[model samples]
Target: MKKTFLKIGLLFAIVGLLAGCKDPSSEAPQSEGPSVSTTGESISEPEVVLTDEEHNIAVNYIARSVPLVIERTGSTIPTNVFRADAEPPLPIPELKYGNDLILITYGELKYEDEINGVYLYPEYTVTYSYLEGENYASFEFAVDDKGDDYAIPDYPRYDAEYDSGGNPIHTVPPAKAARLYATIHIGERSTRFNIDMILHPQEIIYEFTLDEARAQPMGKIVKVYGYFNGYFADWNNGVICDGDVALGLFKINDYREYMQIGKLYEVIGQYTVYHGLPQLQWIKRVTEVAAADHPTIAAPEAIVVNANDFAEQLDIGNELSGPLKHKVGTTVILNFPLRYKKMLDRDGNPVEPGSLELGKHADVVLTGKDGNNFEFEVKLSLNYHMGIDDQAAFRDFFVANPTADIYFTGPLGAYDAITLAPFAFEGSLSLTPPVV
Candidate 1:
């Protein structure tokens, strides 16, 4: 079996796990070359202990109805008078909210780190879900002083601070933040991450009130507001959808429409960490309309969402979040594996004799799990000329020989250098099927 792993997830999802690396955002550090001038002291990476009272204070501070900054004795040092290599190391900080979930996050300085030989993927993954029992996101980072690992791909990180209109709030210098961010991917479930921002010199300026999604508006201006889900960030117009625990559908007008097998999209939708991989709510831009004057009246042919001029008034619904464990059927619908077989040869190229060769069997399906009751029309490969016509022939053959029991005999999908044709033979399952 040729296993070619594919990446699927949100634009801000996790990619690879490198040891030693703090967070993906811990790159292109702030004092890359050291601050221009002043009393340059920074927060050092230390093992600090906090009491239950302190933890509650930090939690309450973050979830406050109105954003306010809390003073940390250790963070009293300012960012003035810093040298390129004089800055301290970034540490992994955690805060337990007692009632709410725990938050373990690294500071933004890590993302701004500028050690000549040290390089980390600009990947930030902090996993924490309100969904009990299952929730965790980790990362492994390694710094190559010799710069041997340098096959860096372009993973553009969008800082939505200016509202598409030019404005600088939290101002950081201009640099690629050249850190290797791994290929993004989608997971098999929904996840969430919690981030808190702390300022230097002043105080913890503004905190997230359990709803606002914060973003880097300008160099130091961190804009905080309400975010719908942990995955969907309002900064990029991200929205979460239903039936998205597993396969997410990412869509946007600004992005390329045509999707290829290997091509990946940094889709800005709702996402979370699931089973170590980044799982996000599928994001797709769907035009929905509502009556501008009255929020309800529908145009006659208003079936299409775009039909309503006041589409902006309508809201995107939330995911079906209840108990973390929703008892699906005895077995999960997704777990019902589709019986498949590689009717083709090792060389994804067509077989000389387009016919079902001996030594080949298939897992044939009699009906679709959706009760479509569909038995695929099967056709044995005739003479090595693989094309859509062959699929047509299979349908034709199935119509003629409905009971011939001829197993599939053609390449399901074979492109240049890539041959993955897991042609389904059956639909149902045996033994213990999966559950949602």
Candidate 2:
């Protein structure tokens, strides 16, 4: 894994800091207004999906229902205690509640994917506060004890779990869902909010089955988990996974390096179309999860086919148009004798050593039994996509032994179906010398 946890690992320290500041006052504050219930009962029916207008109204109501504390900061009301670093801070009314309990101004609607469906919830910012003067409390936020003064509090920071007596306690739930509740304490007084979240089954692409993913609606957010079956082109960032269902990943840079061939991971991104193929775009998160065992990556199934079948699969125009097109992005071995053809750059020119450009593709062809040929492109920059220089050693060995059988394994370039074209990338090319 490419250190996906390295950055997230730092979040634990922030959790520890919040845990140490537990409310010490024995007398909890008396909550005024409609008290939130902790009873484990559904406010809405199971599988109820909220419409966009209803979701807006519900979110506004929840934000307004939360308590707000007013304090004098030079007669200016700042929205929240946590402020981003800026020069000569401007005047804004500070709105907060009991001992920096909750940040109402920064309320945001968030989603969580669960076994049943996608759950919606609200996220509020929490800060550290202390008694100041006779009746007021002062607050400060930070990235750490160093008092950076611009730290953002982590989500689900408020307690949502229950104790043995059924009293609401602070703890992260196993799965963050839409219809969840949070009970926060301001001094001795604790208040609970029963949040009925919006349900969007279609928006949650991670919940898609293999068949569902293929036909999922476009223009939605996806938070799905699957085994990292490595990448497509070594050029741009792309990942292939199979689990809960088979899916593809794209435009995820932060956690791409950590992705391994067989490790399980939860990826969050926007669902969109790329090059006529369905893929997750603008990936927000790529988190590793524990799986029973590494997923078994099956080798590409070899096949014997006539020229027409090969051409139809290699043709991009027919991709995803029907089942007749080859399966793109799948590994396939071509047993046909593929000559050592020249590599061409994006403009279709011969790419000499160091002449290869980034973001451009190189094409290679393989002739079939019917005297027909198929061509495929490889992005020269991607480590997975090998260049002529990369094959110098292997090419030399082939020169010393002309009749040796060679094999290559890699995903096809066509956006839809698997193709038998050779993409000389790393771990895709091999030469088994003739048996003695």
Candidate 3:
């Protein structure tokens, strides 16, 4: 069996090598988001994927997806806390077969076979360092998969497991999804991602299975919190996590505009146990912006990002105190998830749905509002024929204005980044200084 696996692996290695290293500048569509394609390229000489060396490429890739979060800032991911009675269950689209709490504890380098969907990875212990001000809160997350060198949070016997769909089961119910901020450390290198969140109310609907959606007498809207990066924003932020939430992610354009990897935001998602992972469903984005003090903007050699139609720019000064001024109505949209109903149909449901209108909201780091994060429904029309999801378009949704600030978010707080929620300013916004 080992030899056969090796033979197949060797053949795949050759094919992967033949695929060649793709051009870095080349762009492709990503179902995950508008990010670059992550297909591994082949080198002239295919290197052995599983290296005896600790912390290899496989580990790094997984780490990016499964972050080593530090809750030095807060126990919950969101600072704006709502009653549990309000939100729905977690992992709205439902990745696995069981109602297990799904948690994405961490990611490490692993060699995966495209044909078999198998991952060969190493094991490492996960630990954390708590900072001051952030209280400690115990959260639950099950390690669905662990490797020879990898040890999952709970499962003790095997390195990994498979679901009915044959996909790898990796989830951890976010124990601290309600935290205000936390500094996480992963692996020996202290790999950490600082996550700060503020939870609030939103109109999220995640209960309708595909079949049930069509049978509904009327459009059933649910409410949840609005999540946005940079908790420092003065207004409410986050998305509604109603309905088959994952189905919602598919309906928006520039989904990354609503969310990203290394930043702070308020996630108003449903708190449910999917495959043993605690997760919040984001229906709308109260706001979204880059990190403050990050090298993406702060470098003396910083180059402005832009294009005729769409592009990103960096400010040498404080990211707070203003919005990254662009065109009159330039909006970044996220493709949140939403699924169809699962109700019984005699003749089966129609082959096509309204392209699956997923829950969506604009990416805004609110300049002004009462809550740190918020998401409101606005009348939006889509020109799906024009390659744009109406939900992704910018609408006069959030009432932009500034008052209080959610300090749990670091310097690049939305309130600090934006002048007002609706963006009402005659002149340029004032420069924001770095937080000490």
Each model's Cα RMSD: 23.8, 19.8, 26.8
TM-score of each: 0.18, 0.43, 0.17
Global CA lDDT computed for model 3: 0.26
Tens-place lDDT per residue, model 1, 294-407, is 222221110111112111111111122222111110111222222322234433443423453433322122211222433322112222222334443433444454443222
lDDT per residue, candidate 3, 75-126, as tens digits?
2222111222225622101112112222223233446667866556543333
Model 3 regions more than 4 Å off: 1-67, 70-124, 128-138, 146-204, 222-436
Error of 1 at 149 (Å): 45
Best candidate (score: TM-score): 2
Give the lDDT of residue 134 in candidate 1.
13
Give the lDDT of residue 300 in candidate 1. Answer: 16
Give the least accurate 10-residue stretch of model 3, judged by summed lDDT: 408-417
